[model samples]
Target: MNMDTKSLLIDTSTILFQQKGYKSVGLNEILKACNVTKGALYHHFPNGKEELLITCLHSLNEVIITDIEAIFSRHLSTKEATISMIDTLIHQFEKDGTITGYTFSSIVSEMATMSEPVRNACGALYENIQNIYCKKLQADGFSNESATSIALFMTASIEGAMMLCLTQKSADPLKTIASLLPNLLNSLQ
Candidate 1:
């Protein structure tokens, strides 16, 4: 039950933070959203909102890293795996009926400047994601330098595409990126 409450808090806080930035979400809001009392929240996150934010970021990061690992594990070529990843993201956005950008983007934009811990957590998450892409590219025969460079470019492009899609309230940006990413990666090869 302790784990359940902590998970609930993380989940609820994730949604709230994603929707309303870190600075805007209060303990009361999280408590109401999770249906947990102050003591329970404090019990799980003794450091309060900052702790909760860091925990939520880490949780979301782990989930994405796991998903990326699963995608790469399918033995697909780097190009195919990347396409699959974009398609999966598109499907999720379509299903959820919202394109709020990536979770890290939301938090980093709001809190990275103000909190060192938040900045570090966000930095690690981004690096992990880039590493996933780098490994895939390297496995596909790209050199270390090339793979690392391309991974950074690919990650940045996708993040930009996500932001564009979210801002435009349409999947066209992502779809276009998905269509073009294969060719772009191939060009690097």
Candidate 2:
């Protein structure tokens, strides 16, 4: 299997998976999109569709983790950095006039029960996000319990809000959610 062929398969699948939910996308569609034959596909991914999908998930997860690390690197306190990251997302969603519908949520929800490897990969992504949030909050001076709760709330809240925004095709939800976080923090104090 040519290395370019494998990368091409993963790249094509990523776009399709992101635009359309994983379940909605078919392997033939990906192969056609990549202009690759069955032999090449199987050569690059012997485990077949599941293996390929897992690779795609891993690629996406790595990009997000790297982005999160960059976000985490630039602040004296966790609150500032966390808020900034949230704000960035909010701004992006607002620019589009809706939460762009995160692919992670869609992928995890689609494959969670059916595929062990897919579920595990998604779980790792969630854990990484949680760890980043929890660590930041803890460092920012919140008690572990409070930090954990806040982090979890923010995670769920943001994703939920994004889904709503995407469904509604409006960014109001995201912007409002971002604006409200400060109030939430205040209430916690």
Candidate 3:
């Protein structure tokens, strides 16, 4: 496979999988979307769709961590950083009509029971994202337990808000989360 071919496959597959859950997206759809052929796909991903998705999950994890780190770096506190992150997501949802990046929740809800590799990949993705928040909160002087708790809470809250935003075809859920975030973070402090 060529240098761009593998990257193209992973990028295309991530979008399709993010839009449609793991079980809903097929290899043919990914191949067609990427304009990549079966031979090239298999050449790049010998284990096929599952391997490709696992790769996508890992790639997405890196992207999300980098984005969160950037957001955290820009603010003086985790509270401000997190609200900004969610606010950014709200804008993305409004502009793109969906969350542009980030996966795991949809795939995990759909494939966690069926595929071990997919489940593990999704688990790692969430863990890495949560760690970024946890570390940021710790740096801002929250105790480890409080930071861990808030990190998990924020992850769950944001993901649920995203799903609700998708389901309602509105950004209100995320907006509400952003509005409530300051209070939520302050309560723990």
Candidate 4:
């Protein structure tokens, strides 16, 4: 496949993976969406859906990991950096009304159990997030355990807020969650 086809495949696959999930989404569907033949797909991704998905997951990892690192560079301290990262995540959910299925976390929960590679991919994302927050917490003089717990809470709260926002058809849950985060952070201290 050519560069343009590869790009289209990735883009279509990302959206499809977001909406239908990795298992449920079909290769033919992606091909039809991109108006490309199966041969074309295999030309670019010989391993089929799994290969394309790994590529997509890598894309997500690149985007978010870079974003987190950039955020870290800007904040005054680790604590502030972690908080900023949380805020940025919240803003994304709020902007989209916390719609389900598009997030990497949601995708991981659906996929990580079934596929070893996907599981490792999911684990990598979690590890990166945990490390980022943990570093910040340590920098802010927080105990390692407390920081880990807060990171857990932060993940749960964000996913819960997304679910609620999708259910309620508004970003209100996210808005409320955003307001609640500082208090939760304080509680960690």
- List clash counts for every candidate, in order: 0, 1, 0, 0
Q: How close is candidate 1 to the true structure, as a TM-score?
A: 0.91
How far is 128's C-alpha from truth in model 1 (Å)?
0.9
Ranking by lDDT: 3, 1, 2, 4
Candidate 2 residues 1-189, lDDT tens each? 455998999988877877777888888898889888999999999998889889988888888888877888888666667678777777777675543223377554565466788888877877777788888878877889998888788778777877777778776676677778877876775
* Model 4 poorest 10 in a row by lDDT: 97-106
Question: What are the lDDT figures for the candidates, one per model?
Answer: 0.83, 0.77, 0.84, 0.72
Q: Model 4, 30-142: lDDT tens per residue?
A: 99999999999999999988888888887777767777778987886655665566566566656764443324754544664557877777667666766776777777778
Q: Go through the candidates in order and give the C-alpha RMSD of each one to the true structure.
A: 2.0, 2.7, 2.0, 3.3
- Candidate 3: worst 10 consecutive residues by lDDT? 100-109
Compute each candidate's TM-score over C-alphas: 0.91, 0.87, 0.92, 0.78
Model 3 lDDT per residue over 1-189, tens place: 455999998888888888788789988898888888899999999999889988988898889888888988999888898888988988898888988555477654676465777777777877887998899889988999999999999888888998898889999998898889888787788
Where in model 4 is the C-alpha error above 4 Å?
Answer: 1-4, 77-102, 105-113
Ranking by TM-score: 3, 1, 2, 4
lDDT of 1 by residue, 80-180 (tens): 88888888878878887565434478655755465788888888887998998899888899999999999888888888878777778777888998899
Clashing pairs in 3: none
Give the per-residue Cα lDDT of candidate 1 at 176.
Answer: 94
Worst 10 residues of 2 by lDDT: 94-103
The TM-score between candidate 3 and the true structure equals: 0.92
